[model samples]
Target: MIGEELEVLYEVDSTNEFLKRNYRSFHDGAVVVAIKQTAGKGRFGRTWYSPEGGLWYSVLFKPKVHIGLHVYTKIFSVSIAEVLKKLKVKVTIKWPNDIYYEGKKLAGILAEAISENNRVVAIVVGVGINVNNNIPDELKDIGISLSQILKKKVKITYLLDEINKYAWHLLVTYRNEPENITKLWKKYLYPKEGAQIKFKHEGEVLEGTILKISDEAMYIDVGGKVHVVQSIHELVE
Candidate 1:
C-alpha cells in the first residue's frame, strides 16, 4: 500500500489509455488520477461525460494470476463499493461495473487489459463517480451524485482517499481469494433478489433473473432461460 505510486494529471484523454500506453515501463499498483477526461468512454464505446469535479481515475495492475479478464471488473466494482461504504455513503454495485444508490447509477467502471501469450500483461481499471458536481439535465433521470443524494456538496478529496485505501486493501486480499471479492460484489448488486431486469446480450434483447455470478459473468435466468453476459453495458427498461 505504501509502495503504490500515483500519477496525477490536470487533463487527459483517458487515464486508462495513458497507463496502457506505458504498461511495459511501470510496476504494478501504479495509478493515474485525472481531473478531467476529454475522451472518456465506458464499455462498447459508450461516451463517458467526465467533465470535472468527479473521480476520473484508473489503476494499473500486473497481476500474478491468469484469470479471465472479466474477473478484474468485478474486483473493481467490489473495491469501489467497499470504499464508499467506509465513507458512510450507502452504495451498491450493479452487475458488470455500475455502482448504485437507491437504484440509480452513482458510478461506473471500465476495465481494459492487454495480454501476451494468452496471459494478461496488465489491466487498467477506470472508474468514474459523480461526486461534488451538478448533474446534467439529461443525466438527472438516470444518474445521482453524492451531493444530490445528500443535499450538499461532498468533498472529492475525501472520496478519493477512501477509494485509494480500499483499493489497496482489495489488492492484497485478491492475491489470496479472488472469488471472495466477487462474493462481496454479489451482496451489493442491485435487483437484490427476485427483481425483474431487462438485459441485452449477443445482439438480442431479453429479461432475466440474476441467478448468480459464474465464470466471470452474470448467470441470468430469463423466462426460465439462462444466459451469460460478459458486460452489462446496455440495460433496457
Candidate 2:
C-alpha cells in the first residue's frame, strides 16, 4: 500500500519539497511524480540533474511504529536495488544512500521527515532514476541511464510498477522485521573492508578508512582514532 495515490505532474521544482509543502493534505501512501524537475535536490544541498526522460518522484509514508531516519533511507535503497535486479540490471549501493552501477551513479534516494511536538509524523522519500534520459557531457563520466546500459528504451510505467511492488514489501518488512532490512542493505553495499575514502562532514573534509558500519553511522579509522560519521556529503575515493 505504499503507492495508493500517484500524482503525476508535468514539471516540478523538487518532488521532496513539493510533498513537504503539501503533506498535510495528502493521505499516507501518496506518491508524487514529475516528468521533469527544474530544481531537483540531492543529499547535502546538491542539485540532481533530472531531465525529461528520467524518473523523479517522492512517496509519503506514515509508519505505524517509529523508525529511525537512517533505517528509512536504507529501506528505499534496498527496494530500488531489488527492482533494478528484476529488470536485469545489477546495482550496488554506496554507503548512506546512492545507487551505483558499474562504478557510476544510476540513482539517488533522499528521505525527509516531518515532526510535531517532538514526535515523528510522516516521512517523504524522494527517488530519482536515469531511465531514458541522456547524460550530459559533464556528467557522462559519472552518470548513466538505463536505456544507455540496455541499449534500448525502458518503459517508465513498467519501472514504476516494479518499484511500487518492492516498496510496499520493504515497508511491511520494516514494520515487522527491521533487522532483516539492514542485512539486505549490507549485502548490497559496494565497498570492502579497509577501503580508503574521503567525505565532507560539518563543513570540513576528512579522509578515513572504513572500519565498520552500524545501522545509522559508519565507523572509520582516521589518524589513529575511530570517528563515527552519521552523515556524509560526498564520497571521494
Candidate 3:
C-alpha cells in the first residue's frame, strides 16, 4: 500500500524537508508531492531543478532495518527505470542515484534519514523527474524531459500510478531479498561493460574500472589496486 497517504502541494520549498519537519505525524508509505518547488534539494546540498511541469515527490518509510539508506535509493531507482521502460522510454541508471536517458539526466533520487538518540526513526525518499517541463538554459544540455524524448505530452497521473506500483513491489522485494535489488540495479547500470569511471574520495580523484557494486559500496580496480568507494561526490563515465 505505498503512497496510500498522498499530499499534493501547489508549491513547496522542498518535499524532503517538508517530510522531515512533519515526519512524526506521518505514517509509513505517506507521500508528499509538490507541483512546484522553490527550494528543492539534491545530493550534497545541490539544488534540484524542480518546476511546475515535473514530478516532484517524497515518500516516508519506516523500515525495519536501520542502516543502509543507499539500498533504499537503489530500490527507487530501479523502480523508476522499470516503469519508464514499460512506457517505451529507454533509460539507464548511473552509479548511485541518477537516471539517464540517451546520456542525459532524466531523474534524480535523494534519501534522507531521521534518527533520535542513536536509534532509527524514519526515512524520506525524494524523487524529481522532468516530464513536460521545458529545460532551462543552464540545464538545456544535460537535462531532458519525458515529453522531449517521446515528442508528445505525457500523462502525469498515469506515470505517478506506475511509479507507485513499482515502488511498492520493489519495497517488498527489498524487505525479503535485498541482494536482488543490487542485481537489478547493476543490470540497468549505464556503461555495463568495462569503462573508465572516476569518483572523488577524500578530495582525490580515484579513476578505475567498476568491478562490482553492492548496497553499501562499489568495488573498483584502480591502477592494479582495488579501492572500495563508499561515498562518491562526482562520478564520470
Candidate 1 lDDT over 1-237, as tens digits, reads: 512787789999998889888877778877788899999878788888887888888877787775555666776777778777766778877766788888678888888888789867888888898887667999888888887877778787677667767767766767568678767767887755566677887788888887775545667788787777676565665
Clashing pairs in 2: none
| Number of the top-ranking candidate, with TM-score as the measure | 3
State model 1's lDDT. 0.76
Q: Clashes in model 3: which pairs?
A: none
lDDT of 3 by residue, 1-237 (tens): 778898999999999999999998888999899999999898888998899999999999987766478777888898899999888897998778889998789999999999889987899999999999889998988899999999999988788888888888887757667777878888898755466788776688778997877655678888898878776445654
Instruction: Report the C-alpha lDDT of model 2 over 124-236, residue by residue, as the tens digit.
Output: 98999999999999999989999998999999988877887787888776666778888898899877447787777667878999898776677889899887877644555
| Model 2 Cα shift for residue 93 (angstroms) | 0.4
TM-score of 3: 0.90
Model 3 lDDT at residue 25 = 86
The better candidate by TM-score, 2 or 3, is 3
Q: What are the RMSD figures for all models against the true structure?
A: 2.8, 2.6, 2.3
Candidate 2 similarity to native, TM-score: 0.89
RMSD of 3: 2.3
